[model samples]
Target: MRVLAIIVLALIGSAGAEAREAQEGRADLKHEILKRLHDPNAARRRDALLMLGTFTDVPLSPILHSATDDPDPGVRAAAIMALGHASHASNAQELIPTLLRALKDSHPLVRRAAAGVLGRVRDPRAVRALQEAARDRDAAVRAAAVEALGEQGDQAALTTLLERLRDKDPFVRRQAARAIGRLRAPTALAALLERLVREEDVDVKRAIAWALGEIGNPHAAETLRTLSRSTDPYLSATAREALKRLISDATARSRRR
Candidate 1:
């Protein structure tokens, strides 16, 4: 009991120290942000906006809104990202409509940044808009939209993700595979297996392998074992690791039953 009490006391002290450090860190960051915000240089202000996109960020209303129209493309992109982070941080559902509108921003970078924020929101309001943005002309924007759809945790995204697996851009296909894993639906496993066989990109194959591990279905064990023997060292190593994970997970489940 003394040892347990000592451990508890240590944890309490550690937590208190962490809290104090966080408070101090936020104060320092805010001061720097303010200094940069008031600077005559647009680059400095952009730097401020970038910091404001972080976890300790406080939304500088109307300012952040106006920053979205800054003359510099980089500043505008950073501002859009900051707004989304701020909205998610503050639970400002009112910001949803603004973020959704940003998905159509003239700049694909702005649209990409906005898609990221909406994904964090995970609000149903952003789902349809994200789906449309998934078809954006820019591959990066499409990848971003697919990523957001995955984070939203909506079952409706399952069909969208399935279709995106065949996207011309390999990045989008990988993101789709990762999202399908996030859904954890058994039905997605077969599609993943089919894609895994035809997928030539090592990165996409790795993503699929990790997704299969996330699904934790023993049915993938045989396929994983075959991939584990492939000539590609990275792919073979990852597949072997995933195979072990599947077997251990299956064993745990069976024991519980």
Candidate 2:
């Protein structure tokens, strides 16, 4: 019994010592990153922000928060991305204000990054800002904002996403279709079907088909069946898959009744 107790004590001591060493190592890394963030070179500061972003286990929000104001737009964008990486559900809401401000940054790249991160944060408070960003002049920013609003899953942003389905940019339209699918709102069915009929972009058509499948509306079954006969193998396959989902969902609903 005495020997067993001594062995247990030794193990506990070893574990405690290892934990302390890891904590010290993390502290050292944090100090080095902080020092580099202040470097005169913008690239160096951006690099530090990138590195800090990967330190998800560390509570470095203060440093990342300040970096968002860096003079270099690239650095500011990187800081916003880093903040997204470091944030989790518990602390995400705390940073929504900072992200909202970045969403309005004069630099398109910075605004794009902010919109993308706001999606990761998934705060309802950002839904309105993201909806506004969906109208950004830059196509890339608009695409990012549309994607973010989809991530928000708020029904309030549904109208904006539906409007983006007709955006001049095919990429934004594709993203809008996918976002509508993510929402899985039956109300979006008619819009998705309408766009699918008029969409010349094969990629956008495929996204619309996928959205129809995700919504699993029986009304879409006839369209999906006709689409399944299309010459484009990819589109036909997507439509066939959507039909399967509609059938499966119908079965589920019947069983529930």
Candidate 3:
């Protein structure tokens, strides 16, 4: 009897309408974006957020805040991006902090998405949060944070950026080294030089060589000279070019002094 009941249940579930409704509802979803902004159903709320971000009809900041704290992480991630996608310059001040909070979400995707949105914010207040997120467990989030720090372009971030140069993930290290290059801080010369000597990752070595040239300090000249002798042709060529620029820049600075 039990075997017969199980067979009957399997046949009933095989009928297609329920499966079709779920798939079709997701595909044909065109709910009134604003009316469903605070809908009780999780699916409706998520759909509303997607619409609010993709469409320009909604300018709902209150709905954005509620979504930011939604029990569903996917909903919260969408809400964070929606704030930036819909907001103009006037609302950047309010949106930056919320975006920073999203970086600390338990969900890796949320943190990664928040990191990307924060980079576009251009708010100085976001620098500290971006720096902290450079240590995020997710490589994508760490890379995004490094890129965001570059967007800030503040010399104050130099120390934090130097620390990331040693990140276990070569991608994160490369991104950090690239951001350091964008800063053009002379103080970064020592760190960049050390990384050039110690870093085994070829891409990271190349980025360090570029950052040394960008920093343009005479202190980096000898490091560049040493790297120019490397067996790796690419590193040798980059080092030669960087040495020329650093020497030229140092000569120019000495003339001015």
Q: What TM-score would each prediction reach against the true structure?
A: 0.81, 0.88, 0.69
Q: Which stretch of 10 consecutive residues in model 1 shows the poorest summed lDDT?
A: 53-62
Query: For residue 1, what is the lDDT in candidate 1?
Result: 100
lDDT of 3 by residue, 1-257 (tens): 99999998988787666888876675455356666766788777777887777655445688787789999887888888787787877777888768877888999878987887787777667888888898888888898889878778888778888999989899988989889989998777777777766888988898888888888878788878888998989989998998898888889988999
Worst 10 residues of 3 by lDDT: 26-35
| All candidates in order of TM-score, best leading | 2, 1, 3
lDDT per residue for candidate 2 within 1-257, as digits (tens), equals 99999999999999999999999999899889979999999999999999988886666898899988899999999999999888888989998999999988999999999999988776667898899999999999999999998888888999999999999999999999999999999999989988887899999998999999999999999999999998999999999998999899999999999
Per-residue lDDT tens digits for candidate 1, residues 199-252, read 899889988887887888999988888888989898888888888888899999
User: Which candidate, 2 or 3, has the higher TM-score?
Assistant: 2
Q: What is the lDDT of residue 195 in candidate 2?
A: 89
TM-score of 3: 0.69
Judging by lDDT, tell me the better candidate of 1 and 2.
Answer: 2
